[model samples]
Target: MQVTALYRHPIKSHGRECLDAVTLVTGQTIPWDRTWAVTHEASKADAAETAWVACHNFMIGTRTPALAGIWAKLDEVERRVTLTHQDLEELTFCPDDPEDVAEFLNWVAPLCPENRACPTGIVTAGTRGMTDSDYPSVSLMNVASHRAIEQAISGPLELERWRGNIWIDGAAEWEEFGWLGRDIQIGEATLRLREPIERCAHTSANPRTGQRDADTLGTLESDFGHQDFGIYAEVVNGGEIRIGDKAVLQ
Candidate 1:
């Protein structure tokens, strides 16, 4: 197998950016992956309080599908994120500047219905209301797993549905399934495979159009024989990873 594709989500549940290649840094979060989120100031939900923003406290797939088509890229310096639609001009925004980030949030808020439900906003790294508990601020996936999912679905499955921070394609199909509790090398970076990522209603939500399909979960169970898919990994060593980078299972 070969590394076929790479991706990252700048804002949780907002949009995804495809990469020709990427570099993995040890102890450094993946570029633009969940670096920002929307949350609301008032809600009876378990963790609601503070300035309310849409993606901050909630998940994306269930309500917005076009989010799957959105893509992003981090400037080589890792200070700015550039947003893109499939064939549209890329819009660059700074994560460090609150004003700039807010502008971008307002720009895309209208694109999603969830944004309409509540006043939408953006939160970047170190911001008070972004991220989920246990999230390392970055996530990775194996291309092999994508292939397996595609085969099981018997159709073209878009990468945005997974919203992983990194994508590697040099391992056997579902090879990551064997990586639980192990360490693997991707390019110059070493990562510890933590555990199997559990599926949630989020998966059933189409990232491309924001429509929830009740069949997504059922399809995964019937075809893959398990509701589980993909492995979560933590960075063990910092380094740069590029497309076609050698991935060595240690």
Candidate 2:
């Protein structure tokens, strides 16, 4: 298979940005994927929780569709996050600092609070916290698997519905279903397929409009034969990967 598309959230549980190509460092995408997250006060206060940097734990997908449209850019050097939308230009801040982080959280709370309430703190690499998701680092999916789901739905599906860091093409439809426990090579990077990604209420939330589709989970279950799609992977080797990178099944 070939690398079809690449994406990064910058902030967890927010919208995704498509990339023509991406450089994979270690097993994760470089400088863009899940580098920041919004955290609840409990998580922020817990100095022992290193995994609180992931945003999936605190952000509710069922309540807010606007979360899907958020685009992020990360400046790794300066440790800054820049968020942008159609009407809004880039709003920049450093997630590591308490004051700046709080300001950003307050700024976006009104944007998505109607759908779901966000935590008061923003977490990033600079912060000692971790993401809310089960995984420590990244998420990935196969294009072939997505195509199978689309075929079952009898229409086109938005890639944003199932947000992932990497999108690989060229595998047979639904082939990713068999990849659990297997290792795959993409460019110089190596990833071990972990488990099937479970569906959540967020999948029903449209990233572009923030509207929640109650039937999304049901549709995945009824058509896909499972409430799960895509595979979670852990990076075994860090390296640079780009679009068109060969994904060889090892």
Candidate 3:
């Protein structure tokens, strides 16, 4: 298999950024992936600790599918985030400032559904990522498997719905499931496929429209006999990875 694309999510449940190349580090997720999260007002996660908390404590595609419509761009040099959406004007702010954080909260409050918990604050991860998994891991997706799901659903689906960190082509459909507890080499990086990622309600949402238009979970369970579409891997050997890099099972 070959690496067809690379992506990073600077903030949890926010927009995705495509990359041509990136430096992977051992025991860490992709650069800046899920570095920050919008914590809900009713969350019980202690703000004082930098530990990984359940994704329910923060904004997520499952509860607020509209969040998928929000496009976020991070300026690493300035430590600022700029958010853009189809219905709202672009807003940029430094999340570190209390005043700026408040402005961001106000901007996002109206986008949330009434039944979901409202966002109260923006939180950052110090040395670790706030990824969905408790461990620092990167998500890997197989394009062939994605096509299978599309075929099963009898409709087209966007890759963004998967929110994967690495997308690979040329792999046989569902071949990744056999890779659990195995090592794969991509360019100079060696990663251990830890487990198959289970499907979630978020996958049903359309990334462009934020509408729950697809029954991704249902199709996976009924047609595929499973509720998984991707795999999570840990970077055991750090190295540079780029688009078009070959991925070989080790």
Candidate 4:
């Protein structure tokens, strides 16, 4: 197989950014992926949390589908994040600044439903990312499998809906499931496939329109016998991985 794409979401449930390449670190999530999360008024996460916590404490795309359409760019040097939406003004601010966090919540509030808890603040878990899995993870996807899903549902869905870190091509449909508990080498990095990532309602939302436009879970249950789309992998060896690199089952 071959690596086809790379991505990182600086803030969880906010936006996604494409990367040409990245350096993988052993036992860590992809760099800058899910570096921060917007905590809601009803969230139980403490702003001072020093370790990773469950994703339920954050204001996620699952709660507000519109957030799936938001786009983001991070200026790593200045630690500034820029968020843009079709209906909102461009926002640029450092996530570490309290004032900036407040501004971010206010800017994103309009997209949130009134019945749901409002976004309150931003929080981080030190150097580790707040992945959906309890363990630090890098999500991988198979393009052929995505195609199979679309074929099953008789509809096309954007890959962005998956929000995966690495996307590989030339794999058989659903063949990634066979890699579970096996080590795969991508470029110079070796990763152990952990488990299939369970599907979520957040994926039903169209990433381009921020609208609930698909029934991904429904189709999975009826056609695939399960609600899972991707696999989570733990980095076992640190190395730089780039687009177009070879991916081999090891």
Question: What are the clash counts of all predictions, listed in order?
Answer: 28, 17, 0, 0
Q: Which stretches of candidate 1 lie over 4 Å from their true place?
A: 41-56, 76-80, 85-92, 95-102, 114-119, 127-138, 201-215
Candidate achieving the largest lDDT: 4
* Two-way lDDT contest, 1 vs 3, winner: 3
Task: Specify the highest-TM-score model's number.
Answer: 4
Q: What is the lDDT of candidate 4?
A: 0.91
lDDT of 2 by residue, 183-229 (tens): 88888788888887787777776666566644667777887678887
What is the overall TM-score of model 4 with all chains considered together?
0.98
Candidate 3, superposed: residue stretches over 4 Å from native: none
Please identify which of the two predictions, 2 or 4, would achieve the higher lDDT against the true structure. Answer: 4
> Candidate 2 at 86: error in angstroms?
4.2
Q: Estimate each model's TM-score.
A: 0.74, 0.83, 0.96, 0.98
The alpha-carbon lDDT assigned to residue 125 of candidate 4 equals 84
Question: What lDDT does model 3 reach?
Answer: 0.87
| Model 2 TM-score (2 dp) | 0.83
**Whose TM-score is higher: candidate 1's or candidate 3's?**
3
Please give the lDDT score for candidate 1: 0.61
Per residue, candidate 4 scores C-alpha lDDT tens digits across 1-250 of 9999999999999999999999999999999999998887677776644477788889898879999988889999898999988888999998889998878888998999998888888988856999999999999999999999999889888889999999999999999999999999999999999899998899999887799999999999999999999999999998999999999999
Q: Rate the local accuracy (lDDT) of all candidates.
A: 0.61, 0.67, 0.87, 0.91
The lDDT ranking, best first, is: 4, 3, 2, 1
Deviation (Å) of 205 in candidate 3 = 1.1
Q: State, as a TM-score between 0 and 1, how close model 3 is to the true structure.
A: 0.96
- In model 3, the worst 10-residue window by lDDT is 42-51
